[model samples]
Target: MTRSNTARRTVAALLTAGVSAVLMTAAPAHADSNDSCHPSGAMPRVGVFGNEFAPAPSDPLVRAQGWVDAGLTCSPMGSFGGYRTDAGGYAAMAWRLTESMEPSELLSTGSVTPLAGRDDLAPGDGLLNPAGFGHAVVFDHWADDAHTSYLGYEFTAAGVQHRTIPYPYFAGQGDFRPVRAAR
Candidate 1:
């Protein structure tokens, strides 16, 4: 083949490979089972009308801050992106925003990764209480230098809360586990 023709073919092949790679990595991870009653069209479309859920970035602080900046509140209308109340609602927000996966799906699919311990927790990591009732908190920062206490945002009947939480209280019985977004 002519040099020009060969070069053209090489460029086309590289471009094709690049596009394929982008599509593969850009697509959100999916699970065969999703029990959570996620709102229709909620996965991709965020912050419409009443919904305040948005995907968190890789940075731990950025993830938590997204909720604060969006003024997210725990509400029953979580699927619709309305105010989301309680830890489950917060889970819905975090799971949806971070992995584009539902919270229940994370549990069932074994996609959630366990952190070594509370000390391994990061600002944007999650403190998931999957015991009696599922709850999730977006870790913001350590309240003390020791990391024994932390400040985070959670949804509640009263509305969104940013409070200092003692590690022992939340991590009791190992129910509140530190987790990272399923990659």
Candidate 2:
């Protein structure tokens, strides 16, 4: 299989592996340090009071695409109980689907595998910002054959967006790194 397909498989596993843990024990909500960053509201058909485990749709990609396809606005950007409980920021559509992953813990103590570069990105793989409080997104697919542009899904101040990210953005900027849930 291609690296992209391998990435997708890893992400699928990453996204599903934690559901078992979620069933075993309900993770406590440890609010983020900055209360000012807490969620201000909830997204439609998503979560309650910005609770990631609060019966929202479980698939990150599905949730993101649904919001974009329906043009639904996202909840305001806010930090919540830990990264897993975060339901209003860039990680909103994904947190519950994977283990709690703080930016600082990525690829080390966190439950993900890193890639060499963007070319390995696949649908469902995470485009994570290694710089603590930056952007997080899911790679959808390459938008162009030259690999200059790609489709990505994420939640932003405007709401859930599935748009083309072209050169000079993360693809060209190299600020974000490609990652997948560890096998």
Candidate 3:
């Protein structure tokens, strides 16, 4: 064979081998089995809405403050209000606007604090704190008989658009129901 022809074949073989190596090393792109909020074969499409708090502007400010980069998953079975995080990602900040609102005691201690801005607490006061505000909040509203709603908020925090999903209603609270996956 001609020298040029031999060179061309060697180059082609090397290219093919390189391509195969890359394909083998690549991890499979599969739906997160660990994610409870995401249904099987469902890709997570994050959408941002308005803030949960108004007048005082809690939602906008929270976005502006920016939370840590974290992954969250919520499932329907077991505890209706249960939440999970991405191990380590972004930190959260909490802002308790009401005197009766305490997030740490409620989320961690499993104790229920009075809803902020209720008749008992001042109009603008709701348990607002920065402690867990920067962390990603995920709620699994898809479980049957689960009365939790998942809300995703997008706001500019430190000049960046941050996305947050909060479960404000759970277990006989606001009307939160799961959505069926699109066929």
Candidate 4:
């Protein structure tokens, strides 16, 4: 059979079993530490609130594209953002879908759809910054049982970095929404 067909069948079988079982437990076996995710000699600067590897690009679409490309190149899981090159991840994909429509027509469409709630979040989900100007990252999973905190993988100005942010933190930062990848 073709590789694509084989891949689809494998995915179908896994989904038939349960996708959460796969996402919840598929993180790299390595411990959660800066050393584990980031390469040597590339220590992200410690910050008062959040770590800043570098200044993110002013344009949200540019930033999103950079994040997905960087993740594809270096994520230990083999696919960092779980995004394909053609679609250009969430922001770019969303932009593509909404471009033809009038600004006020307001149709939000893309390779992803918003999650109903945080309870529905899973690893590999796309986290959007917000409606107009926004950024995106790959959800890594909650870091605590209370579900108050979660881990995320995003490409920063410095490079690809794993981020530990609280659940409410995203909202406070105007990134209150999370979306699941369509594929």
Candidate 5:
């Protein structure tokens, strides 16, 4: 083959390889699992309040089940206030309520109770609850409106729990919008 034709084929092959690499590394936003919930490294601990309660020590099996369901790892460590750490050694907490987690079951825990109205939740309205699957989650809804709302979750690292609340935004109106849904 001519040198020019050979070079052109080489370039085409390189481009195809590059595209494949990108696709392989790009994971979906809501793949579900501990990998999706907690990135590499360590998770952090957090605190909880109100009627919220942490998973009991004897309930490791229950907590593990919850974590698996939510795509997370449950490791019980200790308790502070009302929050408790899971076997994965991260401080976690959860609240119990019966509600619909339609659209995206991956993000929704089927226990989030909608506040009376937008006025019910303020910018720093923090909520502590057990997210099934032995995962304890803390969220603060910083914004709420007719269209949507925004909140943040507290993650753990090493043995410390840090609060990482995302900026205010919207929630799913009809179907499950996991991107917009709060913890």
Candidate 6:
């Protein structure tokens, strides 16, 4: 081959290799798993919902906040009335709004705290300090009758995703408290 043709082939080969490398790195870590339950196309997705179980906020950060980037600050969403944080790093903050509510107001909101171990959580119940990561997730459902598996919308490094985690993982971590919010 001529000198010019040889150089062109070499350039093409480099371009192909570069594209392959990018594709490999971009692939999902878990091949068999998915992130959310949105495929249902139903109102109040199985796990996390925004503003009265209507639907999750369009903004990913608002839907689920994580440790590093986006939605790092926690705030009460609505009547369920609790606190959240996407605050990055090892920073931990707890805002106890439940203590100030009158008995009547508390009844109206049906807000309960630290109830994870005490009762069978229903879908939509909020999980505080899940996985001991100081992360928050909305209870989706139990993966099994024994309650060994848990599914929820977790605010993760991959953004808000529908995740299924083993109970032992969180149990080992300790301090999994459940809070229920009235619709």
| Residue 124 shift from truth in candidate 5, angstroms | 5.7
Candidate 3 lDDT, 21-92, residue by residue in tens = 896446322211132232334222122222232123344234223322321222212111111211111112
Lowest lDDT block of 10, candidate 2: 27-36
Candidate 1 lDDT by residue in tens digits, 1-183: 999999999999999999998864562222111222333443332233322335434454554456656665444445333324434545545554433333434565565677888888776677765543345667777899887878876554444556777773343333566777554
Distance from true location, Cα of 12 in model 4, Å:
56
lDDT of model 3, residue 135: 18
Across 1-183, the per-residue lDDT of candidate 4 in tens digits comes to: 999999999999988779767764565432222222333332221221211322254333355446545443332222222322211223333233322111111225444677888889876665665433234556677999998888765543233446677773444345457676554
Clashes of each: 8, 3, 27, 0, 33, 6
| Pairwise lDDT winner, candidates 2 and 3 | 2
Q: State how far residue 3 of model 4 sits from its true place (Å).
A: 60
Candidate 5 lDDT by residue in tens digits, 1-183: 999999999999999999998974464332222322343444343442332344544332343334334533223333333333342222223232112111122234433444444345543223332233323333344444452534433333222232333222112211221221234
Taking every candidate in turn, the Cα RMSD to the unseen true structure, in Å, is 16.4, 18.2, 15.6, 15.8, 13.9, 12.7
Model 3: lDDT to the true structure: 0.27
Better of 2 and 4 by TM-score: 2
Name the 10 consecutive residues with the lowest summed lDDT in model 6: 87-96
TM-score of each: 0.54, 0.52, 0.20, 0.42, 0.26, 0.40
Off by over 4 Å in 1: 1-60, 69-72, 78-86, 95-105, 168-174
Reference-based lDDT, residue 102, model 1: 33
Candidate 1: RMSD to truth: 16.4
Candidate 2 global TM-score: 0.52
172 in model 1: Cα distance from truth in Å? Answer: 7.6
Per-residue lDDT of 143 in model 1:
93
lDDT of 1: 0.54
CA lDDT, candidate 4, residue 32: 22
Clashes counted in candidate 3 amount to 27
